[model samples]
Target: MDDKAILHQYLRTRRDSLLAKLEGLSEYDVRRPLTPTGTNLLGLVKHVASVEFGYFGEVFGRPREFALPWFADDAEPDADMWAAPGETREQIMELHRLSAAHSDATIDELSLDAPGVVPWWPEERRRVTLHQILVHMCVETAHHLGHADILRELLDGRAGQGSGDPNLSQRTPEGWAVHRARIEAAAVEAEAAASAADTGS
Candidate 1:
């Protein structure tokens, strides 16, 4: 496949990987803040969708067919980073799906060198090509996918690209506990060695 097609595939794969992180999770788990920064599975999906719409739609002078309530002028800061009480999980998921389809169409229609502008970006760097946006979006999606992987693993100990993915070693809960303890022991040993060297004792 060509460069654009390859990048699009990577972007699409990460998008699916991210959504996979939410499968079998409850509303509370998917939306609950797992970090001090309020990072959550659903919130990450919403943020990525908003970003896709902006980069693929607005940046190219294409108008959106749907409204993003979280991005409205009256909305509070970081609104796109979360789902409001009334915003059902289905709605956010649908938005994420729709955003991907919309972005795919844009990528398919434009040439790699097709020029566009990002008004919100620095003036000197506002002008961009489809190739640049494709790379940018791929990196953006992959970055958030990393966060989703951690959040999902923390939520249920389910890890890897998806549920029961063979990419991860098969280990029982007891086995995993032993594995973790081994790593912990190594860390403690390293820290003690560092302290001793610092004190020259």
Candidate 2:
């Protein structure tokens, strides 16, 4: 395959891996914050969708139809990283699929050296070739897909790539309770030490 074709394939595979991780999850399960930092399966997917649209679609002047309702010009630039109340899992997923199609179309129509302007980027770095943007998008998608993998594993002990084994399930209730208690205890101890140090105790 050609360089653009290779990058496009890589981008699709990474996106598929992320979606596969979310299979069999209830809407609530998909949205549950798996980390203190609010990383979750669906939210990560949403963020990736926004980036695909912004980088591939907008940069090439084929912007997606959906308006980013949560975005503000000057405040909280990473607002796309979280899901808002109105954003459904299906809507986010469909938006991602559409964004992928649009981006792919842009890739098909433009040569690697085709000049495109990223107006939102800094003036000095505002312009780049289609090849540069495609490579950047591939990296961005893969990085966030890795985050989704970890969040999915923490949600239900599922790990690794591809559709996991059919028999996977949460641990028995008693075992899970013990595991939770142990982790919570460790967290409490860590917090106490930090608090004491801050107070010079």
Candidate 3:
């Protein structure tokens, strides 16, 4: 595939990876905030969906067909990043699917070099192209993908880069414990060395 196709393929892969983190999880599990910042699996999906809607839809002058009121002008900050008390799994997931479709349409209709402006970006950097936006979204989604990995693992013992393959060592529990201990010891040594150097200086 060409560069644009390649980018879309990668973006889709990351998006799916992020979504897969929610598979087999209960509504409460996916929505529960494992982190102190209240980031959750479903919330990360919601956040990325809105990211695509804005970056691909509004940036390209192709206005969104539907309104997302959570992040509206007067809405609470980062409101789109988390589901409200009454929000359901189906609601968030459906929105994600629709937003992805809209973003996909923008990617399909525009050339990689097609230029547009971001109203929310700094004035000096407002002008951007489909290529840049695609790349930016890819990175942004990847960020959430990583978050989902840890959050999912925290929810259960399942840990891997994706649903298909975890890419982690197949070591037994004892082996993993030893490996973790070794790493901790090394970290402690490194910290001590740094502290000694600071005292000497």
Best by lDDT: 1
Candidate 1, run of 10 with poorest lDDT? 160-169
Clashing pairs in 3: 160-166
Query: Of models 2 and 3, which has the larger lDDT?
Result: 3
Clash totals, every prediction: 0, 0, 1
Q: List the residue pairs that clash in candidate 2.
A: none
Tens digit of lDDT per residue, candidate 1, span 1-201?
Answer: 999889999999999999888899999999999999899999999999989999999999786887887788898898998878998899889999889988998999999999999998999999999999999999999999999999999999988774377888788889999999999999999999999999996
Reference-based lDDT, residue 112, model 3: 98
- Give me the displacement of residue 41 in model 3, in angstroms: 1.1
TM-score of each model, paired residue for residue: 0.95, 0.76, 0.91
Cα error, candidate 1, residue 141 (Å): 0.5
- By TM-score, the better pick of 1 and 3 is 1
Model 3 lDDT tens row, 1-201: 999999999999998888888889887898888878889889999999887889999899887877888878899987887888888888888888888889899999999999989999999999999999999999999988888888887788677763346578777668878998999999999999999999999
Sorted on lDDT, best first, the list reads 1, 3, 2
Which candidate leads the pack in TM-score? 1
Candidate 2 local lDDT, residue 10: 92
lDDT of 2 by residue, 1-201 (tens): 999899889988988888777798888888878778778888788888777788877787788776776555764755676666787888888877887788888888999998888988899999999999988888988898878877877777666663344544456668767988999999999999999999995
